[model samples]
Target chain A: MARKIVLIGPQRLQPTLAATVESLGVAGRIAAVTAGWEEREGEDRELHEHLGGRTTNLEAWTRVEDVMSADGELTGMIRQRADRLRAAHELYRLRLAHALDAARELLKREPQAGFEDLLEAEREAALRAVRVVDASHLERVSAIHAEFGAEAQPARRTSIRKHRAELEAQLKPCELLCIAGGHVVVLLHRLALLDVLGLWGERRPIVAWSAGAMALAERVVLFHDDPPQGAGNAEVYEPGLAAYSGLVPLPHARRRLRLHDGVRVGLMARRFAPDRCVALDALTRVEWDGSAWRGEAGTQQLDRQGHLTEVRS
Target chain B: MSGFVAELEQEARRGHHALEAFLRGRRFPVVDGRSVTFVWRGEADEVLLRHWIHGLPGGLPFHRVPGAGLWFLAIDVPEGSRVEYKIEVARWGERRLMADPLNEHHAADPYGANSVVHAQGYAPPEWIAHDAEARAGELREHAVRSQAYGGERRVQVYLPARFRTTRRYPLLVVHDGEDYLRFAALKTVLDNLIHRLELPSMVVALTQSPNRLEEYADDPRQARFLVDELVPELERAYPLVQKPAARGMMGASFGAVASLSAAWRHQGVFGNLLLQSGSFVFTDIGQHDRGPLFDPVVRFVNAFRRNPGRPAEHIYLSCGVYESLIYYNRSLMPLLSKSGMTVRFSESHDGHNWENWRDRLREGLSWLFPGPLWMVYE
Candidate 1:
């Protein structure tokens, strides 16, 4: 499907959200997903002002809660899935951390006797181990989704189907979809529940930043290098809508990642091999026009060798 | 009568009342009676104070005290207002601009020198000043060569008064070392904190940058020099904690970037990071950043977020509320915290300068090291 989306980094105080939407030239009614704001879901006044005051905040979290309240069985299933997911993620993170540590330590060792070839082999194996864990987690998640679909409970389908219809009705008049950054997991969950990607027609221009930008990727990767307390890991959390695939958007990259280390940069580039690791700093905007993606000045992509190269055109 | 008139009368009898009320030793803008006096000691026909008020520039003529070399002007400035001013001395038929020699507080500007007046409630902590009563630390200098940068850099090591070769201490590597040492009065602050048993006795290394912008803004070479060369040298010479959590990196502005970069490159090498008024410029953010200088910085910060491998143990971030970088720093706190770091954030009623960074050192460093966790006050 053709995709028309602009992914922004973080907006912080210097908000480029409104200007970005206006620049798209599709100036009409806008539908927004602000589930990322969590408790501050109704706080869309600032966003509305930026979007020329013609905005509708789809309270998708409320819809999810409604669906759960309507169907106890589905609610139970969701709770089970969440608990299992949390448990699995704990183990997955532990395994991934151990493997990554080993891989990094191996990379740190001084070269000796066919060390380049041997190191390459070891790196591949380490990456493979990490990938295996990620694959298994994805499989488990898929299985849960499969079971939910196969159950064929009318109430479950009806609850989701009604919400989908409501969301579609709300989106029908909107010319653009504006996604604001907040809690990624909440935003992603709400977007998935609302089936936003499915409802968002291919021709419509979509503007998103921060966590919202991350949710449009093929796989959402969560990362933070110098967190306050614990060491942050770049992990493949879950599958995105895949509406806009191939690039991983890192919002607030300056504050989160350790981009100065070539080894770390190269390792990240290699881990997500083939898919470009894109840096979406504040004011950075990248547009995907169906076939090819374009970036504004100062946009950067991680090269295979670990250096940050500017995104041209 | 009123408290103001009574205080005025009391001050009049004190002889050096003006100097005592306004000038604290040499610094100016000390409050006396509902007014903050700006004092300048120089030979001139006229001395004018130029500053902005309510978005408008205003110049006030300094009053030359009778038969005294001091030219003084008092302004009713609200408490906690940070203002920059330059003294325009009209002499030799030409007016000359001069920074306040007595005030050590100033903003970082490449254009011109301007002295900063930290009004009431905005002044830096009094502990930073050199106090004879406070036990001082010894700062030893060393010159180390870096194969990565292909240059020699000066590094100053601060050893706590009770330092012992047998006892291992946490190593804190500070970027822009000399600036922090000179401007921030870090040695004196460390001395006071350590003497008061507020902070644990730790080893501090202040490393001067060859070229701050080139080396600190996401430079792998500088990162290598820090993690590979400098850190190793320090470990060899001093009994330092080998664990990354036991090692710390501290710097203000670009130096903060250097510290973060080093810790990021060599994970498990540095667990603690104290970033004061860090110039964490991202590509799209920090509109007021140095155009070309911010290019690499933006790139590096972006990349780190994208591939955050593992976080440091304890990350401490402190920035001034009045600085331009405040928005950038505040935005970064949540992101860093979300990345799973035990982050302690603090803000000062100051701007992006050494004094601002110095003022928050006690809070930031104490939390990171928590050395005096068990210390009891007598």
Candidate 2:
């Protein structure tokens, strides 16, 4: 069966979720997963009102907290898994920094008569190095997850099963799933733990924005050209839920990434080749209809030449 | 000499006709690139540039135009620097400092006002201005009885726009509240930041002191008044978050000393602190050089260094590189970090003034109490 998905920009400042849903002609109950909100997980009054008060907050963060408190053994294993992921991420970050630096240095060199081809090849190699690092990190994270899955057997755990059952029951009546943006990892963790995707069924339409959009992709890449502290290198965080594939959603790209610098833009695009590097700024909307993608006006994707082009089918 | 200065000198030498017209047409303190030329068109025995920027000479002499009353001094200020100064004029064996007659820009403080010079790339932050789109927060004055002070203290509480009684909010207690409102444009900054989603819409308590120099010098009574009297009163009145992490304290200069002292003495009352250009004078060996006014400050800072405890979870400290107190602020960073507290230290090219403190508000407030922008985007 064909799946339907809609990706929107961040909804905090200028909420477009309701409008986007209406544009898609989607009506009925919306099962919202605001686990990313963390401490304020169930505080979705504004969201409910925006969606005409038919939104049922899943409260996945609270549920996970409850589960962790009640089940000590599972909590310990989860903590161990987190530590392993952290170590993996640190190692990935180290490699990514060096790779990105090399790529930047190569890109910084002005193109000369004879050195154009040579520099291009070197740039490609540097980009490949970044990709290799990202792939290795993703592989390690996937291995850790697989290992945890086999050992912990979350399906057999009574506490997880209870929560999963309740979530499934709550989701049964809802026609659409709306995921709000927040700390992507937290949202991923909660959603993955309860297996919300599995419960919702693949055929139902899903709408997500910002970090939520990133969470829906097959691969999650965290990018920020300039952050308050640190080297500001983009790194592969972890594999996403694979609700959608073949795209890297860069939310708040205008604010976070230096889109004007062709070198950085081209490097990012080439590094994540085969997958379109989409810039999802405010008021951006894109839809996937099983086979191809369609975008509204002002939707942009990073091209091989580093220029922002209209998103094409 | 700069081209502009040379041109003015040439014009003065040629005749007074063009020079007078040029002076009338153009503004003083001509900023070209990084070079700023201060022009004074008056007769005097000598003219000097008196500025508050540390490391630079306190007074730089202005050379006469040779044949004209116009005196000029060109100084190279770094990019994005805001300098406050006065023109010291000497005549008839008497010297008096006065604001530049040609410069209209001025920054006012408790003492008085100083003529302002904005070098290349220095502009007040856009967020500091009043935005019509941003909903304004309400500032209500309250009189709280203080046992420590043995009197009634007036505090202005700022409740965010669309404030709900059911929903609780984080509280930020600000020292020198009236001064911040007047000079720093605190209310406008808060409204804009909150509206922009760069800062969470939270309650702010603006406090003032009858005698700040004495009281804000890390007085125990001041700390007791804040942590014990003011906080409890605010908690009872407003729907403030009860936990320590939800509460923050902020102040500049001597007020910073009071904030740190209150947090230190109370130990876990305020989880966040925003200290700007703190007058944290300390002596490593002998007595300090800041005179008697900083005596209490030096004592408290020295004590804090000796046994630095975990006063707050997060501390945002900002200081101007031009201020003499930068060294002390830099010294305190390591101590605070070593005490197992999350510390973010920032330094600007400005000075220890209200505007400098105002410029740092966005970073400090946003980091301490992040809004939906950070949460949703990252």
Candidate 3:
């Protein structure tokens, strides 16, 4: 089966992306890491204190440090499973070779005078006799971390940054990173984290959505704010994220954020890069394959309406 | 075999990706994909309307839950009627000629309109058209006035389907224009009543309220708004008698109150009176006794003793025991009868809701002018 990316609606999809990074067990090659958890102080003060009780509930903050600790275990399991599958396939191939030898030695008349007749007579009989591997053996080698459930806690935020030079001095292999919505807000913090892990010098896959989706582009925009409301009626506020331009070659969410920005943003873009345009609905996506990045996003080629566009055709 | 139906469960399990994507900026684990709904939540709680939007351009499918009868999806609808709907099925597409198995309240589709009901407790009416056309005229400018007080308002009008430009027809005013002409399907009612000779061939003006509460309180402003605006507006659209006795007023609830008040204040303009659950004791409501409203009812009653009035030659009053103001209706009935007002009083065991008032409207028509069941005004 192919590996797939699952997404929820724009609002909820943010936390899910965060969970995947936690599971990876590495935030670059950084030696130390910390994550801010969005939380609410509740009626029960004890529960609040225990939000991220290290060994008990790692959810109080981002589990970058705890995640790195599990990296060795996951890497070892993956290698072991890959080796086991290769060994099993090799053993099966050896048995077939032995059977081929037996059939050839018995059937050859004048030292392979006629190949077709020998194989039809010998191979057909051997295949009927063969019954090799069990179903359980294949299943064991093929289990992909199948199920994951994510729960939403109240929103609390903290930032973690790492020293790139130190991380590079210690790392041996590479890693991948994905970001969305909330991640976009704290790009500077992420850069600090990524820089420390820069030691790996390995290929990284970066996927961003909404704000996180927009930050990967040349610039970032703040789209929403609370409007004038009546007494007791409050408006919700969503601050904008920092911007970063350089990344790998992939169809990422570059132009998608602008699809929802509407007309005003179009004028803003014309002033900035008159050349660089954004999609209207914020549905832009980019994909990179190591060397070069290719992307498809944005609503209008003529005007700059920074709305997000839909992902699928 | 398109296998579209089979794909539905798979599509749902996959979070309607086959339909649309998740919001950007959110990581959606597989488990969170379930329990997603498209309709926006939160709004005022005045009226409840259940609709099927599964049809393209947005729709809710007309699907039947297992073991549950048709009305599995119903909402709580208000008493007033000015509703729109389109039947939507998953695979077949949006059906214009859809029927409501839940709502017993049937309205007219003058502009190929649709029938709808509240999402819950949707019981289809006994007499809904199974094969009616969906293209019906639109509903507009249909409110009636209250006569007892001077400051109340409402929308109501009478329309003769095949009215001749040169001819004039006797006008028949019915309470609750929305309920009678729209929800109750008065055009169809008149079609049947006039053809059978159970009622006369007359123009019907179904009354409506401004705020409903304002109309019920017997506010004089609402009354003027109705007479000055609604009556003239309906008259321009449909041929109606400008004189009082030639006109009729009818309603139930505050609708009943408004009808009595309209005739009380403008008996010279509206002669016939039809009251269902009329609140005659305006003393309780702030609208009555404001300036000179209390005098109109008493003076009308006293004036009836002398000349018996040219406008009130025909009057009908009916109330249910469960209604809050039925006693006042009962008390006023005796006084109107003593004043030589030709009053037709009826009693039924029901509440002050649409169902009771609607049933009384059916009776009021018969009592006023007995005729064939299908002698329509047109």
Candidate 4:
């Protein structure tokens, strides 16, 4: 998470992109795109009037039909899904960074010896916990990393004066850049941010929307298929981090859904795989005040597609 | 409530049929049982089966008119519908159906539950569906919160009965918390079994040592974390019996050795030993005194080889007869038999999977508690 860049959500990102167009913001220099939704469909997603620690809400979802153009809605759906996966990956990496921090902190407690002492009994005491894969698969993971090939590194450290001079040259600071629909660009941006952060050891705010959102995690397994009605993607899940943690970033949810006309929840349920969620309607995001991540209104939440009922009125 | 459609008891017996109470009141016993051949235009869900015998507690156990066990009391409903309901055994006496074995949300009390046919199908809570979708989005949350490694498989929290703000409970420390949560179905079992009053009111901390090998072997750091970190954290959150005898340690395979060794090393902390499918041959590590592998559980079994005032009062050791490690499982059985450690052993048809372990969990909990009725200890 390069705090310099953040994407709010698809709808919010749309308006933010517009705002960027007017004021030449961080995302203004770079193009904003989305794979899950077409231009029209992507435009329909709204921006949150507010932001905070609240969770995925039911009121924030915009139907795929409403978001994308009629002719290219299907393609838009595929892109949206890919975008989500990549965004999830970015989020996972951000979390890994946090877990590494926590794991490091545990070392302080058991400074005398092995890491076994650092693994809190409470970690194991959690009656409700899940084991992803084991150490046996470490080699496979390494191979997967190798398959991706060695990524290029950022510029190295210069003299203190030179570094300060470069910082002075780069006077314009980093701001949050949110994107929706653009799966590849979004993922590229996340990778770029992660690498930049690793090189400089700096933390920045990042809020991504839709595909951009899903790209924030560890690995983005693409789920790009033509949705019958809506503009969204089918997501496959994988492991990324150790605990439930992250800065809460809220995304505005849209009203009404398209694909399956409203039955996508069940499809999303069975297909979302392990450690994943569809988070309809509302989704928010927030900042961390050291200890825990807190959310404010409209910041982050999985908006529910309100339960259907027959009303007395 | 209008959003909630009801679910009726669906029997699938060979030659019986179901009758809905609502339909019964509306129409005649349309499909009479006496009629050799009967035909009715009814949706499977619409017909609620009532198995009512004449003189029973809830007048249950009678057959439906034209259906059998495993039949669905279906209704003409759309695929996206959510509903809930139960069966009403409307007969003339005290004999009532125990409860639907298939239904996870069953009666808290099997012996006595009002036979009010609740016709509601399985409708997951709002949070479940939200989190179900949000489960994907929340990955960042789980990954950061946990210290395991890359990601989280699942989160399994065991909320014991007395684990409210009012009372305290002891810890029945366990390893491989993930397997216990997924395969063992500890929460569901604890909920139902406790309702049945089978096990004692204690907390079992099903855990997993990220460093499984060393933790299961002779790793003091792993042991210290469980005792110093895990124990106190659980003590803060849950209710515990607290005393050494009241506390226990249990596991299978490496976990089995870990449990026994943990108790052995910290004798006064853990007294009860539940070793299942343990590999105690010591052939792999034959040189290191073979003690770390075999000493703890064996010491608990022999109690210093001279009945040392029974260090552990309750001990349960079980394993599949056809298991790869049956030698270790069986050899220790006879050795453990000497102390009359309130043992009950059996051979089941399943191999080494969660299924076998799940079956054993119920039996083990029952043996531990024995309920207020079958008080073996007293």
Question: iRMS value of model 1?
Answer: 17.9
> TM-score for every candidate vs. truth?
0.47, 0.83, 0.31, 0.31
Instruction: Select the stronger candidate by lDDT from 3 and 4.
Output: 3
DockQ of 1: 0.01
List, for all models, the DockQ compared with the true complex: 0.01, 0.26, 0.00, 0.01
| Model 2 error, position A96 (Å) | 3.1
Candidate with best TM-score: 2
* Per-candidate clashes, comma-separated: 19, 0, 146, 169
Model 3 ranges with Cα > 4 A deviation: A1-313, B1-158, B173-175, B181-183, B282-311, B372-378
lDDT of 4 by residue, B39-96 (tens): 1232232223333221213322222334422233322322222222235333344332
- B1-378 per-residue lDDT for model 1 (tens digits): 334334434554555756366345444555554467777777899998876342334678987764556677777765675677788899989998888776776764435557888777665566677777566789998878889977787789999985778668888888887887766778888898776555777899988776788888878998888888988999999999888878888888998888787778778778889999888866554443568888888787777766665558789898877677877788888888888888888876566655567668888887887643221111
Task: Output the worst ten-in-a-row residue range by lDDT, candidate 3 chain A.
Answer: A147-156
Candidate 3, B-chain TM: 0.51
Tens-digit lDDT string for candidate 3 (A41-128):
0122332232222211212123333333445543354355446645754554455445434433433324366586865565445423
Chain A superposition TM-score per model: 0.92, 0.97, 0.33, 0.37
Off by over 4 Å in 4: A1-313, B1-157, B283-311, B337-344, B372-378
Question: Which candidate's DockQ is highest?
Answer: 2
